[model samples]
Target: MQPLSHLESFVRSAESGSFSAAARQLGLTPAAVSKNVARLEAGLGLRLFQRSTRKLVLTEGGERLLQQISGALGTLSDAVAGAAEAGRQPAGTLKVSMGQAFGREYMVPLLSDFLARYPAILPDWHFDNRQVDLIGEGFDAAIGGGIQLTPGLVARELGRVHVVAVAAPGYFGGRAAPTHPSALAGFDSIVRRSSPTGRLRTWTLRGPAGEEAAVEGRPRMILSDPEAMCRAAAMGLGIALVPMPFALPALQAGALARVLPGWYADAGPLSLYYPSKKLLPAKTRVFVDFVVDQFHARGFAERMSGAGEPVA
Candidate 1:
């Protein structure tokens, strides 16, 4: 098959009726344009032009070829230009995956302002507890912690994932508040079961002085979702180890009290995950930047670290 340049040269030369005019349009020398046309004719095994010193005339085959490819070339050029324009302008359906509780609590609130700013961008969000295959599942972005950094994916750290023990203030009425991680084992605990592994999740808390202690929560209620654990704790079901992002509102509202203020388990970094930065779509790029900026502006990283002032 002839290269696109060859087809372009032939088409332009035919349209202009002169090699020099085609060369001027293509930003090439007349000789180069003639050579490209000749190469195209040779590849096609059909003479496409009857050349003259004064003007170039299209042969029967050239006329047929021109008729076949001219409109197609225009359409291809339009498609390319449209794609480039779409890249420059942030306007598309942005599909994002995030945790159910975290998305509702944090990201969903940002939608009003985000849509107001980029009115052309339509947000399609999926809320779930498990990690999603960003590229495979055709997701624009995902927000969560502990997601494996698979090949072809990039993560921007929004904050640290810290799990703090929390429970209703009344649940601690008769029993003494646990000062150490080991003491958590004696209380009625609401623990999460790993979604993938189906095994009980354990907590290893790190103190301010770098002391580590394993928490063996005696599970009165075994749940799969962190938000459910927080709700259970709020209902005075048991002491629950919940991620700060899921537990923050309850703590601030006095619905739940921090069990051990000085200790928290560093699960991993909460991140915005997307495909590689190369030729990243405008919608995804803006959304990533917006979320990161918002997280920084709101001090979400520090507040979710469990090292902030007690919220109970």
Candidate 2:
């Protein structure tokens, strides 16, 4: 009989789109990952991945098998870790997915304390600018701003994410600042694909009469990374509606100035979400409890913000 380890490796390699990346994630050598995948394929007598020198493409069969195995694999992993470390500590890996911009600015640094406190639990992190399917790809948890929760999953809100509409000092020198949301059409703006919304984002606010101020204009630059958009806004490329935390340091340094402060829309909440389970296995329970405790005790809602009324 094929072991769960072989099946899990094959699924991760396929989902990650490469052996090397999956190997790095699973804390195994590339050769080890390759051998395990080969073992699984040989046992089934089926070719799961169509491999090239540059990449691995999943076969149709691989996709179906991934569906069958992913849920079971998660359960098995939770089960084994549960059985082995019952009273000692939560051991084994927790897969965490997140975006590039805020991950660098916040989550990465915050995780150091988490790791130190829970030495038995290891986090296998996937950082990307693109939104991933949590259920299909099998991430244990993801911390990000602007996540829209799907049904049957649980989204634990950390706090409100503040945003600022900003431009370079030179860009606004002689020009009138946008006092009304309708005035935004006159400026060159930068647009970013919001990972939380899974849409080409637009800036919106409530006008004086409680009307939705739809700020639409041609973007001088379009980017997926929030950090890039913040940098571009500071360099005078165009106006950028950026998360306050991403721009907070620069704003403090006087490198960027807030434009249309009254009309700026608050960012969606930062959250750590997971697939809700009946058992809430020991590892998930411990981590979730720890995270909730960490934030609630430290007043995360007040901290992830820059300034202004509470958006949540």
lDDT of each: 0.84, 0.74
Worst 10 residues of 1 by lDDT: 73-82
Give the per-residue lDDT digits (tens) of candidate 2, residues 1-312: 788779878977876777777776567877888899999999999989999998888899888888888777868776785677667766668887877766675567668787787787887888886566665455777877556677436888887776667777678778788877678788998988855565788767654355667778667777877788888988989988877767766776677777765555666787888876544556567777777777787676775554543232
- Candidate 1 lDDT: 0.84
Residue-level error in angstroms, candidate 1, position 177: 1.6
* Number of the top-ranking candidate, with lDDT as the measure: 1
- Which parts of model 2 are misplaced by more than 4 Å? 1-84, 145-152, 193-200, 207-211, 297-300, 303-312
**Tens-place lDDT digits, model 1, residues 1-312:** 678899888877877678877776566998999899889888889999887888888899989999999778756654664578673558888989998888899999999999998999999999988877675465879998878887558999998878888989899887678889989888889989998899999989987788999999787989998888899999999999888988899889999888888799887899999976455667888899999999898888888887655433
Clashes of 2: 1
Instruction: Look at candidate 2 and tell me the lDDT of residue 157.
Output: 86
